[model samples]
Target: MKKQIALLLSLLLAPLVSAAPAPEREKAQPSAHHVAIGLPDWARGSTIYEINVRQFSATGKFSAVTADLPRLKALGVDVLWLMPIHPIGEVNRKGPLGSYYAAQDYLGVNPEFGTEQDLRDLVNAAHAQGQRVILDWVPNHVSPDNPLTKTHPEFFWRDEQGNLTPPHGTDWTDVVQFDFRVPALLDYQADVLLHWVKNFGIDGFRCDVAWGLPTPFWNEVVRRVRAVKPDALFLAEAELPQQQVAAFNLSYGFDLHHAMNQIAQCKRSASALDEAYAKIHAHFPRGAALMVFTSSHDENSWAGTEFERMGAGYAPFAVLTFLLDGVPMIYNGQEAGLDRRLEFFQRDPIVWPAETHPTTRLYQVMTKLRREHPALHTGSPMRRLDTTDNATFYALERTAADGRRVVGLFNLTAKDAKADLFDPALAGEWRDAFTGETVKLDALVPLDLKAWRYRVLVK
Candidate 1:
């Protein structure tokens, strides 16, 4: 009886052993591709905008977003990130509807939004407009009723009784966490990701909750995707620095976002911006790209809208993010200054019009200037200038390889503040970017900064 039991175990294990060795052995061996192939340095100077297509317009379709591309491109955006477009799960649906993150099918598009042709056309149009499109990818979990759940139940996490469990520490009852222990599951996911890049011609992926998955899995995923498309960019929705050298082109900058949030909440002075920049500059490597945003989908949905979160500091924060040594992201409707946080699991639509919005102009000017100025293009240090009154102000000058310099100053307090051109390197006859008024470096630049206004002095 013991011999028969051992024979049964061998039969069960033999297939897996034979299957795992080939892939594992291939990955274990180093290849020419093992060398770190960094993303285009030009991407360092670009800005990213998050697009929640379902909630972005009244129509909530790709056609609606395509209409706004000219405006967004005019706003100086380099990348457009469309939220998950796959079908939502109906099983154990939360709230009045299902969540976009709860993907029901990896390869299928959500017909509720539009047909696959619509997505392909969107990509083609964006490429023609010289803007890149990145799709938000949810790899950690899937909807409970996903075909994989029914067909390959062994591919997901299970208890001793083989009951599947949801992701830990949340009321996310609609989805089930995948079991990375299953090698077959990893292959399927990689293949799906590669399929979109090859078939739909997506420029990149913005992986959601990237840290939840095993690091080695990402290494494999990135490797497989790059094998098909060498120029593909990967943006991890995580703050960890380790994700940079291997799996992703950039990672989210939560610390910078926190600092700006603090300023907006009145918890910290505008000088806090310098502290945040310092932390990122010192910790992250020089070539690494940072995703700087005033607010993202998670922040808008859970915390508040950008208008609510940033308040007085909204415009200044947007400008800072664009000028800072990182890739800036504009959440959908941010240009319209949309105040209400849309429902995460329901169809909450955005209203748009032809009139110019405050944020729209602000973003347009900031992005255009950033793209035009080489000093703001790279992840380099800002030469700090001495300030006598550090209470509500911080000043720095950034120079590019071509000897072009731009002096940036900020005012955090509600009252007016003053700063003299202390750096001879930056001292010269300069013009204010906002007003286009010429001023001399010999006298103090008369600054009547409202709550969160900033000035960029160009020579």
Candidate 2:
């Protein structure tokens, strides 16, 4: 009778035994341009924003974010990226409020924020406003307490001591890295992502540290996920231009952000951006899109805010992002000019201004202009214009084939500048995009612009 009872117990726990490596996917196609997945039609010429639910409101729930949807819509954001909504692991945590990226269960929702229904409601609310929702996916690692850590131990990297290891040379203590070479883990990861899209009506995925995983895995994941939701958008946190062929619609444009930082510090000239463009032209494939931003959740929490880096030049850099060849993103609280570095692992509500703030007004105008102008859309050709002071001032002309044209001139210096614009395209009648004032541009005329001011003219 004792032997029988012991056998029964072992049988019950057998499913939780350390997992073995699964079989590799066979007959995999080339990762490049398999079926041509591109950005959704509504996403073009639209702005995306990141939302930190834990920090977005006092209640720190999906309901709070749903209530604030109208505000985001009014601010002219088109896509909403919600940070990881999965339960955080408790075994080895970061702080009182643990990092959102540490997911203990792929299939479970974090009850501290809200239930699965709340997430569904938020996605529905966003869709009703013609906005898209993408969940932040942690594909590289999972909380050490994740069920897979015990049940599928072979899927993770174990140190010499036989304990799970974190990403090498990093202080990411809360989570353990996944072994990508374990072919079975790739299948499991892909299925976990697909479950979200199928069940929650999620429009897409903003993959975190996508570079940590093999590009082939992404190619497979993207191909498989889109097999369910054909129009699903995939965005990579990585900046490698090669990732374009890995089946991502957009990749972070770290080059532009770094160049902008240098320009703000007067360490690089306007021509410096040309180098970034050249790199893109040489490496990035035809359909690749860059996600441009002066601030993101990572940048805001780790590096200084845009106001800190750009100082007086913040607005101009913000405008430059909108006018570039990529999509522009607004971080949470950026519109209100939230000047402080928001805490990453804690409940820090955004200090929203009671009245309509200046930065908010600027975004409102830029978003509207982006929607109204065809020249500002992605793939629209840009022509570099000559300016008197290459270091303190910069100018470019964006034009569409349909005769829609926009000329953006920026004075990035701390003092006022009168830059002489020299281009035949500027010798026509134009209207200021901001003030709606009519100004005829002559190649010889120098416009007096305030410190860190930008003039966008349209004809």
Clash counts for all predictions:
0, 0
lDDT of 2 by residue, 267-292 (tens): 88777777787776666776567888
Tell me the spans in candidate 2 whose CA falls farther than 4 Å from its real position. Answer: 1-38
Q: Give the poorly placed runs of model 1, Cα more than 4 Å off.
A: 1-38, 419-421, 443-448
Which pairs clash inside model 2? Answer: none
- Please provide, for model 1 over 1-459, each residue's C-alpha lDDT reduced to its tens digit, 9 standing for 90 to 100: 999999999888443332221112111122222333356665766788889988988888888788777877787888889999999999988876588899999999998788999899888888998888999999989998999987877677754445666775557889987777788888998999989998999989999878777667888889899888877889887765556657888888888899888877778876777787676555554466678888888899998987788777777788778667677889888888888898887789977757878778778777777778888775655676667666577666777888887787787665666755354565468888788899677544444565577888887
How far in Å is the alpha carbon of 251 misplaced in model 1? Answer: 0.7
